[model samples]
Target chain A: MTPTSLNHGASAARPPAAGTFRFAAHTARIPALAGVGFKHTHLDAILADPDPVGFVEVHAENYMGDGGFPHRALERVRQDFPLSLHGVCMSIGGPQPLSEDHLARFKALVDRYEPALVSEHLAWSTHDEVFMNDLLPLPYTEETLNHVCSHIDRMQDVIGRQMLLENPSTYVVFENSTLNETDFIREIVRRTGCGLLLDVNNVFVSATNHGFSPMSYLMDYPMEHVGEIHLAGHAVQEDDEGEPLLIDSHDAPVADSVWDLYSIVIRQSGPIPTLVEWDSDLPDWPILRAEAAAADRILDEAAHSFLMGKSHAVGA
Target chain B: MTKATKTAFSGAVLAGAVAAAISGAQLVTATDAAAANVKCYGVAMAGQNDCAAGPGTTCQGTSTVDYQGNAWKYVEEGSCASMELPGERMGSLEPLERDMPS
Candidate 1:
């Protein structure tokens, strides 16, 4: 069956509060095309020419403050392209209860921008009311799974929408983890009724760091529920054991291997909304735009092959 | 200190506070124009600076250290001198040696 048709928890697991909040009547959905992470520095260039990409994404925390240049620029960008609000510090996987204040601000953004897609990392970053300022890994035990699901449920209820959760790149693994990463994620989706955001670069980084196969991880991933994809660059370093360690640094262009993996996923999944993220040490707008354009080319090819396959099957 | 005298004195204090607030607003307006392109220190909240987060940390949101006086954000050029922060710290034109959250 096609990945789109293999619904894991698409409609059945929505929280009752999902219907409480009303989105704008004209809220647009992100198309099955390539997008780029929206950088404030590229606002002028994007406004000057906004055609190269299908959508733009922003870190939700960056725009959480009261009215300022960030919000103003986002408003301008939202007028032109579909937006994705990617939250970095929700700490959904943390053992603590979700922060009501952070959730309220997140809900406010969802209400204000009405983004086409909303996502957060699977990793936790806060403990004891102190945010660690990084996406820290969590053990994949039954207890942790339950905690993550409850957090996801609360987040969905507060925002009144299903959120996509992105996989993380880890530097270390816990000996107490009862379940593997993919199985853990599958359980979270089964319980929380949320979607998955397949970050191919993250998959590559984690696979390399943990000595797992990226292809094998993708094969086991719950791709049917994937609503979005992320591609970013990583910094390479040596671990304490003198092994290669990859950091999800997002400071450079999409590496060639990541592009290859992204192509494979798109060819199979048939064109999810993919984002090219270059968060630090960013390049010129045209250079970033070129990266998105490259993803678009692959997506276009996948679309053609899918259409042709359907026509041939009908003929048969 | 009779009741009538005290009432008059309190009204004068209120008037002075109001006058000071009005002048402060005017100053802010005038300084706003000249504040462009100035690196103001000891103002950014935790994880909100444009970039840089001391040692052992990389890019944005990596700074768990809140309000590092060394981390400066671009604010209005002339306004940094007037901005007051918690702990009696003032925004500085250059990186500060004080108010580094421990």
Candidate 2:
């Protein structure tokens, strides 16, 4: 059903202590369990259901407003769940300087909530202060890499915590791209000491969009630096050349092929806190939670494999 | 009715808003006041908004352009139609502009 067709959590009450409320004293970490992206549509369902989601994530821009319903909802949700603030507008990859105002607002939010994990895309979302609002790709040049690492360093310093950089699902390859996407990310991790949020669906989508192997991309990914994982649905449509193009549209269920790739990665990475993101055509809360539960099963299997390996090592 | 199917009958748009009764009338009033205060920020060309523009803006970062008469940005109480906004996306009591003001 459509979001407008569902119950509006509009009637929910603000906590009496909301106005004077301060962020809890400690920072919350990313729980190594399944999570779903926080959507206004699903907030009440989340509070109503005790489904085993480890944490919740939100677009940093969504809650950047001064004060209102969005802020109240997020604060209440924060009281119940650990949060991961995934930013889309820091424009870390752009040649333009980072926005100090945006950083200060972000820092204020992070300070207030003390989120366990803060993340942003390796792509740029703004140009000359006009936000395209889409996560546009970056060229993988050495100069670009150094520039991005510095941006990450600055963001980490301002936020008072290390942030995770996500690999973007690209449609067009830059002619100036000099580094492989994986190594490009590896260098950023090395130079900035930031972590990676591996989006496997992006791996598959970019692989299909370009002529590369998703598996190989995953193999070369710096799994050592991964702190979180994102699995989302994408729209597969043909480009002008009749080649398949997969848009990172988080409006559908996890496809079988992407799930297969996730199965492989969870086994190797031994269960990073995976998230299911359904942003556009959001399904009911149960459907989203079931997807999280499915990820939990994969994590469980990964845990089982790791234990078996440990048993074998002990036996040897 | 099952929560998923029950949504068809109740027309609940979001869960957080769905659970408002428990927070008591203070919250319901607060939410209503917040809803009443949503100002249509006209400068939000394309999808430069958090949410509540119109179709194609079901989520953040989805608006392409040309906001309709139904879009809005949340604002503090009694301040709509007065606050200065950027570009042509001027402030209004309603979220939508009915036409591209810029």
Q: What share of the true interface contacts does each candidate keep?
A: 0.03, 0.03
Candidate with the greatest TM-score versus the true structure? 1
Off by more than 4 A, model 1:
A1-27, A311-316, B1-102
The candidate maximizing lDDT is 1
TM-score of 1: 0.74
Docking class of 1: incorrect
> Can you give the lDDT of residue B47 in candidate 1?
37
Candidate 2 chain A, which ten residues in sequence have the lowest lDDT sum? A1-10
What is the DockQ score, from 0 to 1, of model 2? 0.05
Best by DockQ: 1
For candidate 1 chain A, the 10 contiguous residues with the lowest summed lDDT are A17-26
Query: All models, DockQ values?
Result: 0.08, 0.05
Instruction: Give the Cα lDDT of each candidate.
Output: 0.78, 0.74
Query: For all candidates listed, what's the TM-score of chain B alone?
Result: 0.25, 0.14
